[model samples]
Target: MLYRMVTPEHICPFGLKSLDLLHRQGFDVEDHQFKSRAETDAFMASEHVDTTPQIFIAGNRVGGYDDLRRYFHQPVADPNATSYQPVVAVFATALAMALAGTWATTGTLISVRSGEWFVAFSMCILAILKLQNLETFSNMFLGYDLFAQRVVRYAYVYPFGEAVSGVLMIAGGLFKWIAIPIALFIGGIGAISVFKAVYIDRRELKCACVGGSSKVPLGFVSLTENLMMVGMATWMAVR
Candidate 1:
């Protein structure tokens, strides 16, 4: 037996998981749902439990989702574990978007423009990530960015600059004049900061490249992002 919340606005994911687990293990499930907040709270009070998605097997209470996972010997996610998944997802999506955009515009997946589009898309996506929580990004940036540390206000300005330059780069032609310099300046500063903090100073830190709350390492990936910006600006300038 499983009791879980299933309201009009929200369905409990763990409840679904519990049902699936019972089915997978060949145990027939008697699922009980609390359809509203009032019913859920009343049920919790009656049961003397603080959380829902409670599981019962053979009349024995198995507690909540995590408790059920432990009963089945499933590894639970550790919140503090460092993972590259977020940054990897960001880069992969940016590359895919750039390729799709290139194909739509020039009818080719592979082109000289593909690389340009990729970098611009990455900049736009990363800027949006930072802008999602500017205060957090600013705090993270101050940890290692030399320019941001000295100027302070530059930390707040960085995301907007990157966003504007990225949009302008995508527009091309006349916008290159504006975009190139902006990308070059910020990228140059970022590259130097990452290099000094990680390689020169030998400090192990989290990167602010993806966002303030990102667990991305303050090393190669961060440096690569800055270098890509500088390279894109230089490429556009020479062309």
Candidate 2:
């Protein structure tokens, strides 16, 4: 019996745990890590395999992780019984970005009468929290190998950007024109980041958004979020 495991670096906790269980079961297992999706698909095609963690018992494909787990347990007849859903952490990220954009854009409209200072302070705090969430996501997606160098730089930049935008938001309450452009710039960057996460990266891993619910895709929600920012930026730029 040959147990083959194919997983991306730093993204497959369940797969790893399954592999460990297999090892304890005395099966000959070989683990392979792929950097990109193309490599993984090519290897799977060559091996005549369909799913990840493909197990071959005397050269017969047994199935994937769930299959193996069921085989070992044997309370169930089918080896391939499991519910493995793709993690959706992007929605939370989109929500955070959307909130930041809304807060920045509407700062001028919020009156200075009743709890305005508190509201501005809350926006600042939320902006910082959102920035922290983005930093966590950067670390997760880039991994430790490249995160320290590349991710950290962006991490620092984004929080500072958030701070600047927060200040501009406060200022907008006093002088609308001054803060509008600054808020637009910050929101524009946020939109770009969301676009990259959704259209470019395809939300394969978990997003590290700070607040709100986690586990949602970056496709519709992120694209919409970014579009809102872009629209806000364009409006501010024109005005």
Candidate 3:
């Protein structure tokens, strides 16, 4: 088999490892570093290469990185040999549930306030808990300011908005004047969150859902998980 390895600048550890591993496997590999898209195009034209890490086993184009991984690791007849499970869906669902539950419970508690002082006390407790979680998420995804800025922004803003919405929902449920608008607004934010999850997944971006037990990747399954949350939130609001 002849392997024509085309790669961008060695910017990540994974790229370097891939190159080394391919060479050690005793394939007739040619390495080309392309600094720009134009260079890549020219190289591809000259070599009749149609993809990165193009593997030709007896003059047949196998595919890209993922394909190469499967070819080397799995049997030729196993259709599902290369498939791997991703943790994104589970993580996204858990986080969304925790956030939504906090909102629902706090709102319910506020609606059934025992006294003036108790309402203030309960709100204060809820605010502190929400803020702490938000800050944790911000630090996890934002890394004090380099990448995943959107995740950080969402983390910081979402909790505060939830708190405010919770309060409004509670007030509305008790007084019967503000319930519909507040619920609608909360539902809107949930829908927006679902959209954001989808965008991140389609872009193959990393998620910044922080904390000791929350490490998840952004992927298609995660986006679907968020959509479930969106459906629930919308239903809750309407009810």
TM-score of each: 0.88, 0.36, 0.30
Assess the local accuracy of residue 116 in candidate 2 as a C-alpha lDDT between 0 and 100: 29
Q: How many residue pairs clash in each candidate?
A: 0, 3, 0
The lDDT values for all models are 0.90, 0.49, 0.45
TM-score top scorer: 1
Better of 1 and 3 by TM-score: 1
lDDT (10s digit) by residue, model 2, range 110-129: 33321323333334554555
lDDT of 1 by residue, 1-239 (tens): 99999999989999998888878888989989989999999999998999899999999999988888889999877776777888888889989988999999999998988888889899999999999999999999999999989999999999999999998888774578889999999999999999999989999899888889987878998899899999999999999
Q: Indicate the worst ten consecutive residues by lDDT in candidate 2.
A: 79-88
Number of the top lDDT candidate: 1
Candidate 3 error regions (>4 Å): 1-31, 55-62, 73-239
Better of 1 and 2 by lDDT: 1
Pairs of residues at least 3 apart in sequence or in different chains that clash in candidate 3: none
lDDT of 3: 0.45
Please report how far candidate 1 places residue 100 from its true position, in Å: 1.7
Write model 3 residue lDDT over 1-239, tens digit each, in one string: 33333345434343344566567777656554555666656757877767554555556666655566676894343543322222433344434444455456675433223232232223323344446666555564343222235444655664454445446543534432343343345335444543564464344334432221243444443344334333433444555
Q: What TM-score does model 2 achieve against the real structure?
A: 0.36
